[model samples]
Target: MKAFLLLLGCLLATPVLAGPRVELVTSHGTLQLELNEQAAPLTVANFLRYVDDGSYNNSLFHRLIPGFVVQGGGYDSGYSALPSYAPIENESDNGLSNRTGTIAMARTQDPHSATRQFYINLADNLSLDGGRSPGYTVFGRVTAGQDVLTRMARVPTGMNMQLRARDVPDEPITLLEARRLSEQAGGTMTSEPVSKP
Candidate 1:
């Protein structure tokens, strides 16, 4: 009885901690990103909210630049902007750099305008870091399927008929699903789209 009671006490006193890892089930391939909640708490929370809400399913990676960034998390496969939550505060001051494979929040000219859009840095983008003003928030980095992101970057891009936007992938790179690692089907997070026009 004493040993059992001691074990219970130890269990009660042990802290429970969990970090977030989101699987990006995409057309080009799968990508897994590990968020830095301690460094960018608000940003991480906002991102997880969208992940938890299924807001990102079937979203398009609307912007693609081979050596720059691949942006998404705002549009559906039809190229329409998904309804976004109210903007959140910029966590750019978190000291994370916009380096290769890092993921950052997308915002307008206002530093605190991040809502539901994000981008993956394909190269060291020092210019996007905190300068005279708060830069884009770096909340996470691609932990797996970096090559999948690279493949997405190489996709042909031009003016998109749906968005009438330039630099849009001629062939849409769709995010088919997003989920926590523990909840995802076991497979390579990176695989070419089963089918794409």
Candidate 2:
């Protein structure tokens, strides 16, 4: 009986393997994202780098469009932005698709310009997946607090008449904090109030 008990204890003491976790604290509420590193290793590593380096802290969710995506993580509250390093290679070839509740990188016209900015898809964006240009690279998915995203999606937005851009919300939706949740380590990122022009 004593030997059996010792064997059981040893089995119980073994640590279970865990995946990467990302925590997002927004004005609405906090969301915990679990990254599928197996599916997106390079994408996850790049995102974690920004988190650890404080690149995302004090950034604003500058562009929001219901049923489209909520994009942020590179611009300050003032809409002034930091210049990110040369773009990472396009990983759109990854098997992941841009489905609802999935998080993906946002880039300029250049397919590889996706650096620090990211967006959560409110709907399945099939078109974003490599038609002519490379599609957005999906890295993770929301494991919790999706209602907060639903609320953010429903928020009213208007066209930026000056810029002729659509889907700019009247009120600012801030990303209050970001942190890693799983055994894998990362840091939090946030935004400040925007200054007037």
Candidate 3:
């Protein structure tokens, strides 16, 4: 009886591990993302910081390349650049790949320059995997609403005078809100609004 009781206590003490999930409410539609904290802990934490602080709310999908990627989480509805936290270390060596439906960080020429911007792969981009140099860090995958992303990809894009960039959606695709999912309830956790600087 004591052995069985001890086993029960051990089982109860062991914590359940669940990958963090975020629900992105966008003008196109809602997307569910499951992050691999085990593979890319730094990247996942960076993304969750924005989600938890509501910094992603009302952001626009500023870039879209039909056959390549759908990028965002940087500019606001007014086309103004949002403030970002300090850059994070590159975790591209994480086993994750830039496969279709996988979300990865967007960075400058410098490998560790990734901050607030991210992109979702529209196709399998094996060339992005780490080899000669560090690659893009893919921290999560879209668990739902891939069709919405397809729709966003199909939207007409052109050079925006404000952004001075091409591939800007003719009609803005806004991320209405982004919130973390509760591990036990399968419901969203409310985030405090982050004031733009």
Candidate 4:
């Protein structure tokens, strides 16, 4: 009976595995992201909601700054707004930094207003970490396709009249699909057809 209790206790003490990986097939190339649910559960869950519901398919990477971030997951290729769930809590204090290759939520001045929009850091943006304010939540990192993100960073950007936003990619970088890969298939590159700008 003591051995049984010990085994049960050991089983309960085991840590849960990290969240599933998501593959973002974009016009530039594919990027595989490994989410860190253990650190930022709410943020990870919020992102997976969009991925699982196919809401992120056919989306546009509207904002691209050369050495900052590539923001998207809110607008479609036609610049139409995509529906979003309720805002999630600020998980910036989860000890994740806004480092290069890290994927973080994009919010407005309101610290807890992050919904569907997200961005990938092109540089180590440590200033974005929570200090005086609730910083952007870094819930995942790019496990594959760093080169793809590099190519995306070099794309020309300018003011987009349709979005009325600056730093818009001159050539639309559409997220053709966003799907979750099985645990065994995570970080493995698959030969899938990618769309072009």
lDDT of 4 by residue, 129-157 (tens): 99877899999999889999999998999
Which segments of candidate 3 are over 4 A away from where they belong?
Answer: 1-16, 185-197
Q: Write the per-residue lDDT of candidate 3 for residues 152-171, one digit (tens) a residue.
A: 99999999999999999999
What range of 10 consecutive residues in model 1 has the weakest lDDT sum?
188-197
Clashes of each: 2, 4, 0, 0
Every candidate's lDDT:
0.86, 0.77, 0.91, 0.90
Q: What is the alpha-carbon lDDT for the whole of candidate 2? A: 0.77
**TM-score for every candidate vs. truth?**
0.82, 0.78, 0.85, 0.85
Model 4, runs deviating above 4 Å: 1-16, 185-197
Q: In order, what is each prediction's RMSD in angstroms?
A: 7.5, 6.8, 4.4, 6.0
On residues 53-158, what C-alpha lDDT tens digit does candidate 2 reach at each position?
Answer: 6667667777788888998887677766766766787788788889999999998888888888899998999888876668888888998899999888877877
Name the runs in model 1 displaced over 4 angstroms: 1-18, 183-197
TM-score of 3: 0.85
Q: Which ten residues in a row have the lowest lDDT in candidate 4?
A: 188-197
